[model samples]
Each structure stands twice: as C-alpha cells, then as structure tokens.
Target: MTDNISAYKFDWPPITVEGYKKAENKVIMVFNLDVRTPAKVDHVIQYVVGRTVWCSLNSPVNVNILLSFDFRGQGIIVTKTQSLKSELLRLLNKANINNQVSIDFLI
Candidate 1:
C-alpha cells in the first residue's frame, strides 16, 4: 500500500484586513553617501542611526532599521508608514552634508 501527502501554505490575517495590516504598507529606503574617507562614512552612519532611533522613540509609527553599515557607505531603513519615511528623508536632507548623500526608495 502507498500513501500520498500534500501541504499548503497559508497567509494569516488574509488580505481583507488591509487597514490593520501594517506589513503590507512597509517601505524600504536606501541611502548612499559620496564620502570615501572612513571618518566621513562613520559620521554619516552615526547621524542616520541617531535620527532613526530618535524617530522610533518619539513617533507612534513603527520604524525598522534593516541595515546600517559603512560598507560602500550605504544604509537602509524600513518604516511601517509613509509618513515616517518622509519625516526621516526630510531630516536627512536638511543636514549640512545633504549634497554628498543620495536617497532612493524601493517599493
């Protein structure tokens, strides 16, 4: 005798709960600094991480820092709401070294 088994994948909460589903609206923002010196890279990373932490603490929305590293002078931030992303972008753009930094959004 032989037996067959099958499995299926299920997504909890389903798509119907769109308003309460924060994950569906998650946004990824990538930043690249033009600085080549190690000190400059460190400074940029520090400033970004600091601002991100501050925002996360003070804001009601959720903020997830995907990655923050000096490698190639790049950083990535993920936020649950678009407003939070805009706030961070504005803060970063207002910095003195804004000219040396490039920001882009993925999805």
Candidate 2:
C-alpha cells in the first residue's frame, strides 16, 4: 500500500464551472439569448437578475445567477435551474420584445 501511494501523483483542483463538473458531481444549465440592441441587452439583464433574486428569496427553489452579455446583442445566462429561463421568456413577452429576442434553446 505504501509503494502504491508513492507511485501516485497529486494534481491541482479545478477552479472553473467546467472543472467542477468534471471533478465533482454537479450540473450547470446554460441558455443562449439574443437581444437586438445594446439598450435592450441592458434592460433584459437587469430584469432577469432582479426577478431571479426576488423569486429565489420568496420561492423554495433558489436560482444561481451567472450572466454574460456582449455589446453586440448576444448574451448567455448560466443557471442551476430552468426557472430563470422561463422568467426571461416571460419578460420578453411582457416587454413586447419577442420580435427582437431569440433563444437558442428554443431554436
């Protein structure tokens, strides 16, 4: 047993989400969205984050928020649950941005 331990090599732990997925038992859901304009991007992100926080606080299921936006009108939202995705879709509909917003998950 001592000889076997000596033959093994130790490695650094993973630091990113992808690393965590491989090293630990975890799953991350990613959703892709497109907003037609920079202003709309800002608005959509604000709405999503705000609602996610509010819902998480009031609801039993907490949403993990990880959002990335490009000035070029593309964005990606990373969440542990699909609730955030549903919220975003509802927001687009309520804001009358359905024509401008596109979800890759739905496409």
Candidate 3:
C-alpha cells in the first residue's frame, strides 16, 4: 500500500483532465458569490438583488442594525473548448463581491 501510494502521487495541471466522458468536450463550472456589505452607491451593485438597495450608502452607524440589505449572488457556467470560456472567467473574477467569489470545476 505504501509503495502504491507513492506511485499515485501526481499533480494535475489546470489544462489537464482525467476520467472525462467520451464525446463530451465541455465542462461545468460553479461560481459562488457572497457579499457581506452593500455597495457605496445605491444602484451600482445589481446582480442578485437586481435593484437599488437603500443600505448601499456607507454610514457611521452599523447598517445591519439600522437597515436591512440583501448582498449575495451565485451562478453556474457551462461551456466547451470552442466557446468563449474566457468571457465567463472574466465575469466571475470581476464580480465585486467583497472578496467572496469562488469557482469550482469538475473533470
């Protein structure tokens, strides 16, 4: 068992995939967005809530206690090698979710 473990030790690169299904050239990616605080301007942050939130304005007082706000978003991306995966990647990375964005891929 110990010898076999050492033999199986390997790191897979981002461009490499294993156990992929035949005739399937695409892959699925999941994006998780979590926003803890509202945006500085009211109509700026419109992804999940899709509307101008009143608590977007920063104040000395804690907005959580003074007012209620919705801040969080999630979505999935699916595409093949021929499609524009870079566009989807740009959107996922550009989302201003207060450093609460994540992406996962399955092979």
Where in model 2 is the C-alpha error above 4 Å? Answer: 1-34, 61-104
Q: For candidate 1, report its TM-score.
A: 0.33
Q: Taking the tens digit of each residue's C-alpha lDDT, what string does model 1 give over 1-107?
A: 00111111112222211122256333233444433454664455444545443333333344333322223423433442243345445554443222222334443
Decoy 2 TM-score against native: 0.30
Clashes of each: 0, 0, 0
Estimate the TM-score of every prediction.
Answer: 0.33, 0.30, 0.19
Candidate 3 local lDDT, 1-107, one digit each (tens): 11122211223223211222234422222223342233322122233122101111221122121111222332222442112234323433343222222233322
Off by over 4 Å in 3: 1-85
Q: Residue 82's C-alpha lDDT in candidate 2?
A: 44
In model 1, which runs have C-alpha deviations exceeding 4 angstroms? 1-21, 24-27, 67-107
What's the lDDT for residue 106 in model 3? 29
Looking at model 1, report the run of 10 residues with the lowest lDDT sum. 1-10
Tell me the lDDT of candidate 3: 0.25
Of 1 and 2, the candidate ahead on TM-score is 1
Pairs clashing within candidate 3: none
Estimate every model's Cα lDDT from 0 to 1. 0.35, 0.36, 0.25
Top-scoring candidate (lDDT): 2
